[model samples]
Target: MGRIPGRLPFFLETFAQSSIKSHGSRIHPERFNSTSNKVPDMKAHQTREVIFSGIQPTGVPHIGNYVGALQNWIRLQELKKEGKKEMDLYYSIVGLHAITLPRDPLQLKKERFEMMCVLLAIGLDPAHCCLFNQDQVPAHSEMAWILNCIAPVGRLNRMTTWKSQIASSKNSNSLSEVDDSMLHLGLLAYPVLQSADILLYKSTQVPVGEDQIQHLELTKVLAKALNKQTKNKNLFPLPQGIYTRQSKILNLRNPTMKMSKSNPSDLTKILITDTPEEIRKKIKSAVTDSIESIRYDPENRPGISNLIDIYQSISGQELEQVQRRFQDKSVVDLKSELIELLIEHFRPFNAEFSRLVNSREDVEKIYLAGSQKAAAVANLTLSQVKKHIGLD
Candidate 1:
């Protein structure tokens, strides 16, 4: 298919309209179950499951981002297309979350648009997923504020991410040694905001990394608390975690650390849009052990093991199979194959990404339309929340 125009195309609009019609009716589950409960008699309980997830717009996504999250999202979309599952998927570029740390506004604005383009290039159809920016929908912040009021301070204090951030900032090994004054409210209350993001659309499932499980657990707590406080059995469904097969992709430079944009070295991670030469250069320089033979022993040979893991993950082969396949191969040989594999894997996506980049207007239209679609669902949930909390 040719690239879409600057405006949302007619077919996509028609698809959205049809989707709304099909899911127009809303049903609320009755009978609260504090411990465990029976099935609700309401037909609404059979509504298509909602899947929500958000990613920070730091910069272009890296290979780690692809393997750990983006690929899994594509899989989910494929499953939905094949009738293997029925779902309402919402993926957001979390511009708000990006600001919790220091950032250049102009750079951030650029990154957000590029992030949208990247998502589309990766095969996320506007008709299949509501892809938008969090800042575009004001309800995200509004809902976050409402949830913040009920979130326990003690719970936020115990959050390991907050403590770790503080510890890192102070260069301290002890959590207690880090001063509480160094922490910001946004950083501390991020879990509540994350809950708001998920519950705002009544998301039933969330795809998250293993590190974010604590925040998702807090989301469940807030959902249960809201249900109890409002005397509503099913005002919100506790969002469940849909963990990806590869939850963390380690940095190529340092196998012990998770790949991150914050890492100073560009060679440590592979960007989705990285040119063939860049991919070859980075993979060639990737850290590996002195041992000549290829093996997957993470405990002892983390660097080589990380490379093996990346190969298996991208190739969709079992770890044991990959290990056996490369047991006799030299480290240099393995690196060469990995470089070629990545280049081939990203060839089509890079072309699509280039098209989207040149057509920024079309990307914006897609994002705007996605925000509208997301708001329709979010407003419904927010309206019910307001009524229950006497805000209406």
Candidate 2:
């Protein structure tokens, strides 16, 4: 069973100060309100753009994951390198969230390390941005326990992820078949935990796909709820969702569904580490109509359209441009070109990924260092939250 709900841990008091000073916590200094003894409006006053996002550690991510989110993360880092000096990025391998459902113990450890490697290989520089495992920081769960007190069950029930998960777990598509007695508390309330993850970092910008926008909305709601209890009403920044055109990538085997690891058939998705031969085989097997032509018609020709989407997302070309370029090419031609593109792109990155994964000692140290950076900022926020919630 999980730890008792609603009680913030006492360990944070001992840990917060050291972490803050060591990790470069940049919380803006605020003048105290002499009359009310409360912080001033911080909503309009955050000094830095705290950007946060996370990925589940399921091993090497597929091509869809890269195109959908990881690619955008690199873009964000590059933009910051170009001198967005005030922006800070935090990317976590959400191990804790991944285990909400059952997982093999040994595989979890392996996947956690591999996921970290994937981030590094994809150009998420730990020297600049914070990269760590969510489970490494105690304060995330501590803050989550605090958030749970005010989060509404109705809101959680409304979350489509939660709804679908509960349904799938019971092997039933109907809501009536879902038995409340068997409801997993962690699975149901993980969104609240996610809110804690965002608010802990004072994240003002969150990179999210279309499916996750509602979860971010729930974060804003919980932040508002907490701020309402304080005189300032600005303890947390309402983070906005960042979306990319390539956020929703469909499967190769079935164009109707998003490319996901949960799909039993390996042909449905292409992993970043797959060999040239494997990439070629999967692309060739990708479902398409007998039109013998390529177009971006997602409505009637989802199969060919899905391939076009993948090409445009990877090549950074507009839909019209991609269509024009492929207007005369056959389906076989498109598949061949996409296969070569993927193979050439992943060759160097895959080497780096393998090296990082194999060098367990170095990777562990890097992971710990990133965790410390994240913890320093998180613990500082928890310190203030303690004062507001009477944990002090």
Candidate 3:
């Protein structure tokens, strides 16, 4: 149950190897993707599904990240398992984006590794998904610079994430008091880097939360702009966003804001690895009104509604069902049920998470291998892009 962050212990390595074997097969790029599409019964020109998505290195992912995004990634892979077309997936610890704000070098390194453990612990089959640290691959930078040239400054100015930064937002990073004057070029232009991350692999589908829709829209726009100049019109797929949830999970402390790691109050977000006592404490202290009745009303009762949303998302119950189940009960009853539900929901992964985090070197090896796989695709895309743009 202990998490030792520095190095891998022998038993943890043995356990990881055995546990990962059942998760999935290694990502063979030539098998699922690669430049070639030749197969036993398939035409050479048939399109394969290339999925790309990422998360910032927030150490242990919050429950919002799980229900909103991570679970969807796993579910998508499972659904693709039943499909006829081969699929390739790329999930990244987007260190580049993480640095749009300031970060300590030492803490950033630890957080990056911790995020990797969270991904694996949550049942992302390494075999089916190429998990890499985006900062390791040089091509992402190169591609970002390329995309930056064509990306409109006006569009970047309009991004909501950037606007939040301008407003001195605490939800994303309230740790520092910041203003627009304090913002750097990288913070303003990082969405272009995001575009490069998606276009670099010609990602066919992108899994994202509600907050990322605008960023993904910018990706599509930039793709179309580049395609206009290229003789090869279909160089990029104009990646589609696969939204899995109706709404994002809001902060437990403040329902008006989205759940984020940077929120000053630790109670605002529930981490996947939080202990049962922590879970109970956070939920019991969750911000709700004294209406004495539960209803699915976001406008008047965001706190209770957010809790209901959590119950619905975790239990796979309809919103109506959750409301009805909790209607006759007190808010205490609802909090008690949610605490147990969350504890049970994450119990299966707790040991594995601790073990994976303990096996630090083994974790490094997996992502290093993934980075190599990611580089192969990045190199190919960059080559074609260079050929078109006269950079070759």
Candidate 4:
């Protein structure tokens, strides 16, 4: 189908009419036409780019987390302000995904709330974006089950994430490794759920990190397969990956490993809730060579490059610009500048975090309301899928 002009007005009109009819109210033709004409220029801004992205609710995010993912989300929110496009942005706290590994139930629940606060702290306005827990919307799991039935077991086996986790676990002395049967169906079918999370919302664009490109491809494959299997024409649009330019932030101590919440060393990852003193100390002790000159070579000088990338990402400065700025500076000077930059950037976030954490009741209320709003759309799509598959 060709693109519709003034699509927002058309949609709003359809919704208003449906709502009025459902309520047994008389139709007002003039009101409908008046609203439609008011948005004639909306055609220029109409692009069906509904973006969806999620983060596992493991704990508070770090500097790398903000630069790599949340920063892009903030930029997209700003586009809405600029009237760039009519975006229906959904950012999920995927608590379901966090359970594939061992977790403390109480800590997991607390971390989920903390993550929501962090998202708001990072600048995702609830007015422009939908923020909620994953499991709260039943359609995610419901659609996942439908897709799971159609997904090939062979494809699931070929997924590298599960295989790598299994290999790592086997080498360790964990109890989960000893009992092969303990590998639950959910763990094996993680990608299927992930695909459902994206396609269920009819997301047209997904901002993905480098490691998750494969999962996005799997989502596209499952979407195409589902459409074909049900003999439906263009039921689920194939989502495109919106790549972020920020490089993955590696650990402060172990330069090779990505900065992860699961890291045992507290100093290796800088949590968003970390104090200014903590951030300063962490960057000061960040692994750097004994060499004198500062450079941006990732292969030979990973530690220095990692810091440079973080600075560039947050400051919106180019690598060349950073290099020029630090031409004659030593590694210590570079570290000092980075520490001050981080301290100033995160000061507001820490204050907001305290506010959100204090008002747990308000946060819970927002989650419930957002989940209901999200579920209404997701359930509509799932119902259509069921009817198409002869399961209605």
Candidate 5:
């Protein structure tokens, strides 16, 4: 994670106040209404750029997670730092999404807290951004049901994620393996819920990686389908994807695959909280070719390229810049420098993690406050959806 440059005190205070008001029980429902509200109209234009994105809180985030998503989030915060009220941003800890896969309850709870702490430590000013867990907002699931009613079953069947998950399963020996009957409703309808997540906030721009482009397209499809069904115009604004070209940071031991928490090998991913010694060992043992001369050819030299990408992402330098700096350098030299950079980057985050992990009460309060804030906005959207669909 890069340093947050400088602290903008005025913007931070304003953000905190907004979060307080938005999360407070005293805010009138009419305040969010478009007709008479003095607050800047969040929905006046067809292309409102309110941003929303999330990550499953199954485990601590690695360098790849930070570069791929969280870094973009922090940059959005910097835009808010200018006191521009035009954009409403949100970043969530999707605990509900994490449960799609089986997990230990206690460990999951702890991981969620740690993930929140990491986000905060990484300069996600909650005051500037809506930071909360997905389950905290009941309307996410509520609107999901409403959208599910309007969504075509045929569309759900066509989702690539659902098909990919089923295809990858090892239990394909039985007839039930290929059947939709065995697919859980949550798994099948997760994309609908994802659409709900975006529409609930009326988000107009979603910062998404390559993996989620299909899901975002589905969200737009569902939004349009619902509007047509209800005979209402502009019911949900189709969100544009803010695609980032950040290099894909690959696993240390396996240069071909991404660094992920779910990998069976612990050495495959570098957790932000990994000690200095752990980082050094991982990088030192990172798979690299016997070839000399460090270069950025991802296909011909994936191992060294992965390291270079990691270095460039963290340092905010270009691939060419990194290559020039490390030109004529040995693989050992590249690995050694990467270890130092990573250790320094994670130092503050690790400190913040320790503090939050120790203070369970404070973490709980933040989540509780965030949930209330998120649910307030969510409920308003759900109410409109229900009334439009005759569920009221």
Candidate 6:
């Protein structure tokens, strides 16, 4: 989740502008003979880091979600505030991508608003970063279509997420049990769109969970592919992945599975806006071992390890530190302490979320302003892409 602090050279807009023109079709593709244009030599020329991340507008994000991803975002924002790292951060409510899965129209609308609210409630500064809705920006879909033309279908077939979904639905682990007929085009080509999301902003870094590393890899592959195809190395930055330590947070009820909004059981995860009482009840009912000892054994005792993980995440302590603190403690006592920690952390956050939920108009303005900021960057990238491909 943490990156070693260092400065990257700031991207010069003029450099990119001129670089694109130099390789344009007007000069004749044959004349674009340069060692730098070679795929292997396409190193990151731009120093200005663009960090892009998105969350689906599916349901309320759980505590696991916050600790694993959102918390890291806050750290990045703080780092930005300190002027330790110069970067452009873009966060989005990926409403367009959400529709790849089935959704009720009305609920989708509500979830988008709520998701934005949660972003603000979690302390993402609109002034410091571009926070917006993906559907509000046309460039995402436009760029996705353009990228899909060059993206290999065979590579898309190898994508793990879509196949895993099909596997889960059919109750099989083998991908051989599934085929193209089982997946929609949107689902099949979702990685192409995800690549567009990152490339649209020229994102140099993407904050993602381990499950999403493949998607980011696809983004890099597409970037390299495009550079090779267009003979323009500066066209897009191949985004690097920021992998966090606690990226895959387990479910409370079933430690074997991820803490998912789709889990059907509310007790499986703790929402940010959950009341103190609700938090207490949920943690109290959290599935723990009958052995009744507080230890950090994940393989044999996933549930206890999960609770320990949550406790350590919220407390900002190491597992050894947490274990030492609760060495001889019972599960009931552990759950009680976790309840208190969560309530203390989320009290103010819940207030902000409630306030934003009430002031829907203000939330809309924040989203609009963010969308405009994102669109500005996206427009420039898309325009250059179009120009290079002779679409303009």
Local accuracy by lDDT, each model: 0.76, 0.75, 0.75, 0.73, 0.73, 0.76
lDDT (tens digit, per residue) of candidate 5 on 52-75: 898889788888888888777776
Total backbone clashes of candidate 5, pairs 3 or more residues apart or in separate chains: 0
Candidate 1 has an lDDT of: 0.76
Assess the local accuracy of residue 286 in candidate 1 as a C-alpha lDDT between 0 and 100: 94
lDDT per residue as tens, model 4, 1-392:
11122222222222110111111122122222222112112223124567789998888887777777777677776666557657777889998888887779999999999998787666665666777789898889999999888888888866666654554334332333444455677788988899999997788888876657778888998999988987875788898877655667888887766777666678888887789899889999999788889888888899988888777766677678998888799999999999887777777777767877887777776667667767776787899899988889
| Residue range 292-353, candidate 2, lDDT tens digits | 97877887998898888887777776678888988998999999999987787777777667
Model 5: residues with Cα > 4 Å off, grouped in runs? 1-48, 163-182
TM-score per candidate: 0.86, 0.85, 0.85, 0.84, 0.84, 0.86
Quote the lDDT for 188 in model 6.
89
For model 5, what is the alpha-carbon lDDT of residue 186? Answer: 81
True-structure RMSD for candidate 5: 8.2
Query: How many residue pairs of model 4 clash at the backbone?
Result: 0
The count of backbone overlaps in candidate 1 is: 0
Candidate 5, pairs of clashing residues: none
Q: How well does candidate 6 score on lDDT at residue 301?
A: 90
Q: Which RMSD values do the candidates have, in order?
A: 11.2, 11.2, 9.1, 10.6, 8.2, 11.6
Model 6 alpha-carbon miss at residue 201, Å: 1.0
Winner on lDDT (1 vs 4): 1
Highest-lDDT candidate: 6
lDDT (10s digit) by residue, model 3, range 266-372:
89989988998899899999999978877778888899889988887777675778878988998889988999988887776776788878887777777887888
